[model samples]
Target: MPLHILDRLNHPLWPAARAIYERSFPPHGRKPEALLRRMLERGQAYVFVLANEDSQARLHPAAAMALAGPGGSGLIVDYLAVDPALRGQGLGSRLLDELERWALERTTASALVIETEAGAGKENEGRRVFWERAGFVAPDGHVHRYIWVPEPYAAMYRPLPGREGGLLPPPSGRQLFRWIEGFHARAYRGFREEE
Candidate 1:
């Protein structure tokens, strides 16, 4: 199915997007709908949905991702989920690739960041594998926890297509450790008041 992506979580798309989001994230994991709208109004949020582009009617949402782009950069993968029935079809990876492309083409983002549950536990093992297979790099000894999320998570990054396949500031690679923590503290400030 052809996908239809919307930069802002606006009308003619909210319903389907909402369904996917609601199903994908738990209560604390999701911001209030009103908060999402406000973020969109302020240009701090982006929602992309895998829609049936062929139809004019409200398209069905197969997969969706919500991003928080602070300062119009440091694109954070707030949440990503595929329709339960559509899992194992590669839609999630495709959607993520599309989001990466969208961020590169439409914004000034330097990299895409996602916080995934990490550890030897069975719960997070598959999640970790999925991200790694999708081209994300998780550094050793570099991990963090979101304020609202109780579990320890590791940061994964896929730099946007840049010069010589390096970060724009050229500092991330040279100072990878500092960049990860700094980005997390700055990007998730609302949830991490003190970080």
Candidate 2:
């Protein structure tokens, strides 16, 4: 039997979801169980888990990303990670397709936006290429600072329709922080104090 992907929040597959995330992401000094719990609490975000039927085992998610609505604009993907073992398997592309489909159904915003590091070396360069292949483009005259990682990254955008007429101005630090704070609040609802 083949593996299938499902929304973790809707399914409440915390144990399986945490396992997949742990396998894909570095511990980074944060407890994996706690992190997964926080991500689940962020009701605004969606987590897709891939599972295999044959073994009745949730295949560690080959790829994962988080989405949030920022200021009523389209969905913003906060994080995207693919399992190291499955990098070239097309899982990332499939995961993105799911995100777009979900966004199209739920919002009137004309696009989905994300950020990645600039000059991020080979690893991030590959990620940038992946985004490009998926139809995303860099906004004209706009550069984003990706502060979560060790190094900063630039922001990228994928216009759905009608959004091509204009570009959202880059957010100021304070504004960006407020937006992220909302996202964090939702994402870490139950784990806020530890986060």
Candidate lDDT scores, in order, read: 0.65, 0.55
Runs of candidate 2 with Cα error greater than 4 angstroms are 1-12, 29-39, 53-72, 141-150, 161-191
Q: Kindly report which residue pairs in candidate 1 clash with one another.
A: none
User: Model 2 has how many clashing residue pairs?
Assistant: 4
Identify the candidate with maximal lDDT: 1
lDDT of 2 at 116: 63
TM of each candidate vs. truth: 0.76, 0.66
lDDT by residue (1-195, candidate 1, tens digit) is 655655556667667778878888887777677666655665656667776554533445445545545332356776788866567988889888887787777777776767787667876999988888988776455556556667877767767777224454443322443444564454344642232
